[model samples]
Target: MQDNKIKQEIEDVELIIGKIMQIGVLIAGAVLIVGVVALLVQGDGGYAAGAHPSRPLAILAGVAAFKPYAIMMLGIFLLILTPVLRVVVSIYAFIKENDKLYAWITTVVLVILVIAMLIGYFGK
Candidate 1:
């Protein structure tokens, strides 16, 4: 009975995580579409060629300025972040299940992910 309960809980969490992924993708796709639309409205056949700020904060600033590439970059950034968020949620789920090994593993994975992102963002 206890095993069955655990299985059921895990399945439910899995379903929620699936929705999170879907929503994240949809959000990113929508943003990309908007960027395309902006390009269309500007009468440019495509995005204006130029350097887009790679840093997250800089990207946000550019998005605020309504730069098409920046909007698209923000979308791509969020798309990447979605799976990272999933991993975070999984860590919580693992802790709830009292699964120490999996929890520790997830924590390590999260740490590594953060480190990588920092390097990507802050490194030249």
Candidate 2:
């Protein structure tokens, strides 16, 4: 009947959403791994430290010369954003169905990413 068809469609949609979530988790994991590898491959941040410009006012121009610094900052931002997005998604998922494990795992990954980013950012 019409009710059965609607139920089947809902189930299909849920299945697709679940697959997308799994893919998202994998992507986040991959980004974390790549960030670690980058840290290891490039010591000293893999870019020139802020160099003094010829002009006295050039100190503020460090952003232009510090390519690695910019990249590092971008990675750090991504690390932070990932967790924030995960939290939002996790809350919605929790509302639909009370599951804490996914939220916890996302949080743990976020923490680790933040720590690694800090170490890399400061260690540079």
Worst 10 residues of 2 by lDDT: 51-60
Q: Candidate 1: how many backbone clashes?
A: 0
- Compose the digit string of candidate 1's lDDT tens values, residues 19-79: 9999999999999888788867775523345566688887888788887777888889989
lDDT digits (tens) for residues 1-124 of candidate 2: 9768666765665665566566666665665565456656665544456642222223224334543434444444444455456555554454344357765776676677668867865675
TM accuracy, model 1: 0.87
lDDT of each: 0.86, 0.53
Candidate 1: segments with Cα more than 4 A from true spot? 1-5, 43-48
TM-score for each predicted model, relative to the true structure: 0.87, 0.40
Best lDDT goes to which candidate?
1
Reference-based lDDT, residue 69, model 1: 74
